[model samples]
Target: MRAIGKRLWMATLAAVLALAAAGCGSPASNGAGQGDANSGEPIVIKFSHVTTPDSPKGQAAEKFKELAEQKTNGRVKVEVFPSGQLYGDKEELEALQAGNVQMIAPSVTKLVGLNPAFQIVDMPFLFNSREAVLKFWDGELGQKLMKSLEPHGILGLAMWENGFKQFTNSKRPLKRPEDFKGLKFRTQAGKVLEAQFKALGAGAATIPFNETYVALQQGTVDGQENTFNNIDTQRYAEVQKYLTVSNHGRLDYVVLVNKSFWEGLPEDIRKALEEALKEATEFERQLAYELDQKSFENLKKAGMEVYELTEEDKEAFRKALEPVYAEFADVIGKEFIDGARALK
Candidate 1:
């Protein structure tokens, strides 16, 4: 636990330093240059995300790349960087803020530090199903939340789906609220998740997503939670033995672009990019649903003991964390929670 804490702290510190350095460069050095949309010179957009090239976000990114370039008659070129090649989850946002990268699709919870409202999506068991999630992102609440990012130098283009989070551990099958007691779980760097684990009498630590597989394999943490796609694509099933379909949380990303870069784009090119993003986002959401179902089956085939709880069992877990709603209400707003609950 101490070692994991030390590593996490060091990683956080390094990210802060990188962000500080990012701001040192002039606006011209930040990649805010807007090549003429109608000119022969290609407009280059560097898209960075932290996931496998074959993952939903990766595929959608490629889709956007293909469509954007094709739609513009090769006037726009999107260079895709996947699996943290350009920057890890923590660094990518700072990179985006500094215009080091023109775009990124990081987890929505990753923005909690910028605006606590971003943590609204991380509220445990917030959405009953993917349908509800889609509605939330496409409705007024979604637009309101996206609008919140303007102050932070990011343009929230859309909410891209990952999937529901399921609990996994190597120690034992986690079927009840008590099952989480004393367990150490890896969570994203956010307060809501920390509180969620604490509510269950478990210890939670924030670790970089890319480091979670090894952390679980080496017993740095007893368990972790993630979408089926993340667990399967990252091969976490090999290290963890138990899979509890808690459906306790959702993992989604905010497709973002540097405000400066996006604003500088010619109107026609911006319109084209927005159109491409709309299609790509829908494709990603549909594929996310399919991949999520498929990943669960794949995990079982890979020798995982997967378990799903009854409604009563789910209720027990939900009841245990009920306090989290009020605890975060001030930050996320009671109205937003009420609105979301109305959807369910």
Candidate 2:
């Protein structure tokens, strides 16, 4: 009878231990998925870009990280590697597609390799104002552009503005299209941009954004074109002799994610991220406008010869680059170009 009682007590103790162990593990083990709110490990997103943290795109990335974490209640983590810490312009897209990083906000011009149709945005003077550019991007044309990337394993989430692009160079003032003659400028990788410089009888050197400063300092390239925010933040004004506020082209970024990784995320987590992006995008637009103005002022204070184009000056540039439209119509799709022009 004593042996029987001892055996029964041991069995009861083992049963109680098993139940307690199961309860303790249930909340974490039985969570929705790896990134579930109750899961022990949070979902990590590695976001990489080629601009400084104080730049418009950089600040917006941080804003997104903040909103994403708050909305997810710590279930999602966004790690932003700005200034090309992980990958430069030439490599970031490949890294995203290969899942090396989960997110990138590259210039739309950088995506010309993915879909030549993207160059439609690079057309000089195609968008008369930033508002028109945003409207076109938020409409059917933008949706169509984003849809074209799915086959390449890329998913476009949103379009963030970096204000209009201006011309900066070490050579001469760029008040007129004629001023660009005999000058070599560092341009992003896109035919339209190359053609724009070519039309002006200038040479185009395709250099990475991070390398533009060194390229200018070493005289590898005479100059480059970028927004005021980019020029001021990157300190291009210090290296270049001239800054032209032509607003000839729009410099914007397309937010991208790996298609497979995005679709595989928990539905709730995806919702949280989308909400975060929407709010961050709104925040970025206003911030971009403010930064552009502030940076313009800073550039003037930096003592670089700054020239703002008059209406007549822009018209001359517009006329000179008309051939670029015809040259790239087939490559970018005539309808896409037509649609974007219609917006203006």
Candidate 3:
């Protein structure tokens, strides 16, 4: 644990003990999963996320909550903290690694910080379509990436969705390469994004996802980029006026639990949770897709300027980002980059 986090934990436990002494809720086993439940105790879990309640990840989490309750016969409870209420991606990830938090849904792009090998998933324009993105992650490479987290004391559940990302701003429509110049943009706290934006001539800063809506609203940035689902659901459209269909970045949101928590669960509960996550992932993906398309229309209805790029319009972006491929060659490696391009 980080030095401050350790102190906070000690303080929190002390406060909780004081509360219990005053006849508050009871404390059970120190371990995470079924161990506490099997003894007729309710195991309440904190599930953290950075997206709004309407994003694919949020829907999946809600479904997981329903299924978990039914499967555990109300023995397990999942309390969701969306919009970074529990912690931001990197911090929540670290907390989960230390078992300070039970679960989180950080962008795969963020995981690259822990293991550079995961950067392969963040190469812009690498995924031709959402179909391709799904295939690659469900195949060998994705499972291999999951194993990467095991060593850090986190366990991977199925991925929900990050709808393909687009650009939105207040300064101007992103019609050409020069239009994006001198623009200050917000990106998720990922090195890959810094390179991606820098390649496009934008001044980019890594910011926590929770702060983005307010940042866009308050004019702290000229523009920011995200999926349609995020902008519409988080009400980013209420603050910003332009939407550009960049489709340049595809995202994957993974569910991770404390490794010890998952391992200690009963086999039956584990299987049910796995089944629930998969079912919810697919359902949320469909809902996000419907919303992603409808958000453009919704934004239009709400008096926003929206632009869908022609191939020529996208050509400029593709060309501008070409250098990013080479710039990250060492981090992601040419072989893996090529493998992704060849995915079809």
Q: How many residue pairs clash in each candidate?
A: 0, 0, 0
Using TM-score as the yardstick, the better of models 1 and 2 is: 1
lDDT of 2: 0.87
TM-score of 2: 0.82
- What's the lDDT for all of these models? 0.88, 0.87, 0.77
List, residue by residue over 1-344, the lDDT tens digit for candidate 3: 69999999999999988987867445346464323644666676778887778666787788888887787778778788887887875588887877767878887776776668677656777777787777767877777778778888887776667678888998788888888888899887667788887888888877666798888877788788788767777788788888888787876677788988888766877777777777777887788788788886887887778888787977777788888877888877676667667776
Give stretches of model 3 more than 4 Å off.
1-30, 33-38, 41-45, 50-55, 72-90, 207-220, 234-241
lDDT of 1 by residue, 245-328 (tens): 877788898899999888887788888999999999999999998999999999999999988988899889889999898799
Pairs that collide in candidate 3 are none
What would the TM-scores of all predictions be? 0.85, 0.82, 0.79
At residue 173, give the lDDT of candidate 2.
Answer: 84
In angstroms, the error of model 3 at 108 is: 2.2
Best first by lDDT, ranked: 1, 2, 3
lDDT of 2 by residue, 200-290 (tens): 9999999977798999999999989888888988899879988888878888899999898888777898999999999999999999999
